[model samples]
Target: MKQLTFLLLVLLLPSCSVEDDSAPLFIEPIYVNNPTFKLKLDIIYVLPNEKYAKSKYNIDESKYLDYLNGCFFNRHDIGIVLGESRTLVNPELYDLKDDRGNESAIFERETKGTCKPDRLNMYIIPRTNTIAIAGLGVTQRTLITDEFLFKTTSPHEIGHSLGLHHLDVDGNIMSRVKPYLRKEFNSEQVSELIQQIITINNR
Candidate 1:
């Protein structure tokens, strides 16, 4: 009886839903004939700074841009891009605290490489003097890989800095939750991103 009941629950759960690959991504159709947004996104990549100097990852100085470009340009088509070797590209930083009553780092990496003015809501860090990718929890460039982890991670972190949050809290590349798992946004993600780009660029 328990076996049958378990089987039924699994079948009925939302997790059992089928992926609708054929469905067009649900972009809000800015229909911009000419649209504008109050925010501007600046894309930045990780540098081999003290932050990454301590990690097990190693970023390939050569191949870094390939994935970064693919992730952002392929998705949104608009946003300012900063080189990985550069220091905090955007000069905005803020301080914050955590649940343990201990003050936490906030502004350093929360913005990855983008700044949204008043809407900086996703992955925020508080320690560093510059807004960076720390919220991605990948501080060192050495800990990165040419493929997989580091490649996707770089862009994902930058996205958070732009104002994106966890689509899936667990390891989802787009998640804002801690102990993160690098999850990539699906086909649907591209649409949401494009909407913003068109709105921004068309402005």
Candidate 2:
């Protein structure tokens, strides 16, 4: 009887460690061998009339780019190239034609074409390659967070550019909101997105 009780306790030990369903998931890191994917950003900022170039974040665009690159590179081993003088289709592009036919009016405004198996998405806005951080109403101060070098909003878009979708798992770069990313994509998502990118690019 004593031995049976001990065995029962041991069996219940793992269950005791089960966390609450509402608790956030703490994910492990995924270290990739430098991204094999070569990415380009034809960024545009139509927010409040093409203000990405003049926004406070743009004071150091390269710094922002580095942060963006690091977030993705650590995930699927991807590199980013900022395209010059490219005309972005603008968020309004979809209103003109909903080829992909996404129901998200907000997403349509925020994202462009996801070409490779829908992995590589183009952000069309403002006409110059950039993402602008703007606030609606009194939410101006809400964007400050450790998840990004500057603002979390830009990285969200960059995550899509790197083939990451908004996974509810906390800490992953593609999380819908903050902490926007626990910093980078974990091993599972990295593999999933890489295969998606490869599938998309090979097409």
Candidate 3:
């Protein structure tokens, strides 16, 4: 009877171990050197109405910034510092649509009152009328929905704001697909991104 009990316990242990191993563990990268260039970032959260609640939409800002810093500082000696943040309760701007260049029209309206030329302007929305686009970046401005805040989409749009173009490679930061695998910017992109920052700082 004692031997049978021991055997049953051993069988259960393997199943428990299997369950533990089922989930993949993600280890974040470590950085020892501080970045030389730091860009100022400003965020604006748009709510549909005054009564609408603001949740993270399953993605927190700290985690997104952590991932952004890890990729930029670790590779290119670039980092972002939060400068200003605000919440805009505008129903018209919140319901953004991409119909017939309305995205640009709505973006202009959203930033008209709060535009800061010195810092990177990031607007967070609940969702876009278009489902295919996760975000859009033009020059110094960026618009990202809540659901993609913590994904590689954040960095990808920032790359565009810094003048980096899209790449077909699976692992490049500017890739159009494979968000999980996209990690680092290529050497040319690094140089261009740094140059853009320098130009902006000099201005």
Candidate 4:
């Protein structure tokens, strides 16, 4: 009986070791070696009329493009290129109250007659009701506040438009904390974004 009990314990130990080995030890941030996809963007800056504001937000378009490339294209071979861009004046839409269950109506009004299926529709607005919620991305449209125009917010929201979800990883592009540290996407997310780009291109 003692010999049989010892043998059973040894058998169970091997099974447990197998389970541990099956678990993944690490997740790669980039799986694609050569990516040839570049998403196009139609950026629209919505500003208030002269009565409210006279100049556009202080944004450096070149720097913004560099950020996008550094965060996604340089690392994973996928990036975004600016296509058509314009500015509009509408005080109400400029000061966007995007949250509080008012997102759909507000977004629709702001994007009316300007939404394109092939290009990502990005609206640069004055701000939302709260500073914490800086942007919104649904389908292929992304709305960004002027305050976060030059931060990692665009790529973060664009990730959502590409079907990626928020991650708890601090240094991940999809994370909600430490905006400066958020730059990389996990391998799974890279794979998903690649698929999404293919689907969008085919559509």
Instruction: Output the number of the TM-score-best candidate.
Output: 3
lDDT of each: 0.33, 0.38, 0.64, 0.62
**Model 3 worst lDDT window (10 residues):** 10-19
Candidate structures ordered by lDDT, highest first:
3, 4, 2, 1
lDDT of 4: 0.62
Q: Can you write out model 4's per-residue Cα lDDT over 1-203, one digit (the tens) per residue?
A: 64334321111000000011122213223334444887777777776675533245666776676666764655777867787777767666665543444654566676777778887788787654333356776677777776665555667677777777766465676665445576677788888887887887787
The TM-score, computed over Cα atoms with residue i paired to residue i, of candidate 1 is 0.37
- Flag regions of model 3 displaced more than 4 Å: 1-27, 50-59, 97-101, 128-130
Where in model 2 is the C-alpha error above 4 Å?
Answer: 1-35, 47-59, 74-76, 88-103, 106-149, 160-165, 176-181
Per lDDT, the best of the predicted structures is 3
| Separate clash counts for every candidate | 24, 7, 0, 0
| Candidate 2 vs candidate 3, TM-score winner | 3
What TM-score should be assigned to candidate 2? 0.46
- Using lDDT as the yardstick, the better of models 1 and 4 is 4
Sort by TM-score, best first.
Answer: 3, 4, 2, 1
Off by over 4 Å in 1: 1-62, 70-133, 136-151, 169-171, 176-183
Candidate 1, residue 160: the lDDT equals 42
Can you give the lDDT of residue 95 in candidate 1? Answer: 28
Residue lDDT tens for model 1, 155-178 = 554454333444544444453333
Q: Residue 52 in model 3: shift from native, Å?
A: 5.3
Task: Assess the local accuracy of residue 26 in candidate 2 as a C-alpha lDDT between 0 and 100.
Answer: 39
